[model samples]
Target: MNKPLSILAVYIITAVSADESEPNIEEICRFVAPGTTILRPNTCEQWVRCPTAFGAADYDDGSCVYGLYFNKDTGRCESIENVNCPYESNIVKNRCASKKTGSFLPHPTNCKSYIYCQNGKEINATCPNNLIYHPTKVACVYAKQYECELKTFPANANPICKAIPKNKILADTKDCTKYYKCNKDQQLVKLECAEGQSFDYVSSKCVTQKSAICHPLAPELEPESDVCGNADNVHIGYIADEKSCSHYYICNKRANGRPDRKPLHLKCQNEHFFDINTWSCRDRLRVQCYLDRCEGIENGYVNVAGDCTAYAHCKNGVTIKRGKCGEGFNFDERLQICSQQNISYVACKS
Candidate 1:
């Protein structure tokens, strides 16, 4: 992992001076409570001092001297032979939960962005142009006045990344489904869009093929299939999306939900799946989810997430005719008809 090449020392975030100009301690600090130290993963000597998390900003970073290593168990720097530094698996779960806290959450990987939450509505926002978000200040300030990296990987990198600026996402020249991200270390790493979508450069999102425009050399991908149409399931809770076990969403029902039109989106990491049974993220291998398309198919039959009875006819990507099938039948994709046959809830022939 590319880390700061600095000396080691005691870890103290609270005692550290309140520096409005410093960048966030590190993304790893987000997992710990205020005034605590967590061993920087894959590092032997570097340790991150976590801030109190007030305003979702501010933290201090320190490192163990060249010979000492970070010992998370004791929250101190110890000799390599005396320290047993293992990966803290809870970082992922805690990181996910931490971002959900407070009315405003700092963008974990983006320096100029933050999330604003109010009355159950969540909006991703960015600091105005020419300004950088200062978490402690809780406002946008001059980029020169604040010394912060746009992002950091704490991981590996590629030669291609050296040419790109940090925190920049660019489209892959050869593949519509793939894109590249430049890390804080100026390391370029290729990432993929969710299933059935292509990376949109204009909006910088993975959008449906109907609206997505990929690189000139890339072929077009299929349209996006979704499960956010039913009013009953809308605004209820987060539901697993089709084609990906890890991705889930709390969609706006009709416009995609109520008049509020707010959504909670989450994509589990480290092979985690949105476990419907327990209503949380779980090991993908143990939970079965998003196994078929109908659960989130937006057009024609089976229009809602996990609602087999409802059907929505989406015209020009807008719902026009949507309802349930007759009493004895459910929406069927195979025959594209409402039927009950073969004891499989199959579609009937004319």
Candidate 2:
């Protein structure tokens, strides 16, 4: 039986014979398709060796075609195909992978890899631009490659933008409090409401109650004041009291003379004024009111009996306790104890 010729034996013979027809660049250029740019040359073949020419191949690292030797240029591999054609082993100058749109010449990063060069455009691409044909992934992928100039893109682009994928857009927080960035420029802002609810630009997270509430700082009569009347009319000599309410002047033995009284509205009978000298009102005939009114001196309080009830004190709801002179006596609101210091009376809490 005839032994089948081993494949290695044929390959060895072919390799040797292929080395014999090495041609010069002139002959190599002829084999290149017309208008095709021959960037480098083949160097593996021995007979094809020639002196380097202008734009000729440079030192090639073991890359050969049909045993034909070629040189390298500009970091590209040079080699000859069958001694006539020149090709780059490291990279292939190609256009976009899309056969439909004849793309511009592309210098793919990896010689073995293919890149998207849309419609003969040399610009890098984005979402709509030419995509990357990642051999490992074995599928077309959309890259956010910043090479895009403005709005140009490739024709066979996949993963066409579906409203920016909704995941990328984030709201604008005026305080930079929180935000999100999408592959596309769509965003929404978010914040926390005072009511401890999360809120977004579209709506409030916490609904507010609608009823009106009383203010804690509402204005009211001072609880410590001996009298509760119009605050503007309390001071004497500042204004003339109207008729029965004539503004009275108080003489301060220390402050030169009595303050000139000016006209003012009427004030209730139970009013008070701070004495500049004594700093407290007294119940002497000289210190008493011009209208025969009682006064309150230090440790003394005017009583309802029309007596000088000294040291009288009022509790909550104005339950006035008579001074020592009227021991065991306290004013009762039910009895309207405005005159006598009456004990055995109960005062209600407000």
By TM-score, who's the top model here? 1
Tens digits of per-residue lDDT for model 2, 49-105: 222332244422233333233322222233221121222232332233223353322
Q: Give model 1's TM-score versus the native structure.
A: 0.23
Error of 1 at 145 (Å): 19
Q: After superposing candidate 1 on the true structure, give the runs of residues whose Cα lies further than 4 Å from its correct spot.
A: 1-157, 225-350
The alpha-carbon deviation from the true structure for residue 78 of candidate 1, after best TM-score superposition, in angstroms, is 41
Reference-based TM-score of each model: 0.23, 0.17
| Model 2 global lDDT (CA atoms, 0 to 1) | 0.28
lDDT of 1 by residue, 1-350 (tens): 12331210111111122221222344323222345555454454566655664224555667877546566556677644344433221122122222333556566557788767554445678998878777677788898888755333233233222212234465555578877665454344568986446787544578866678675545655443345543344345566666566777775434323322334667877545577667787654345443432323355443334455555565543456667777877666456676664323211111
Global lDDT scores for all candidate models: 0.50, 0.28
Q: What CA RMSD would candidate 1 show?
A: 25.7
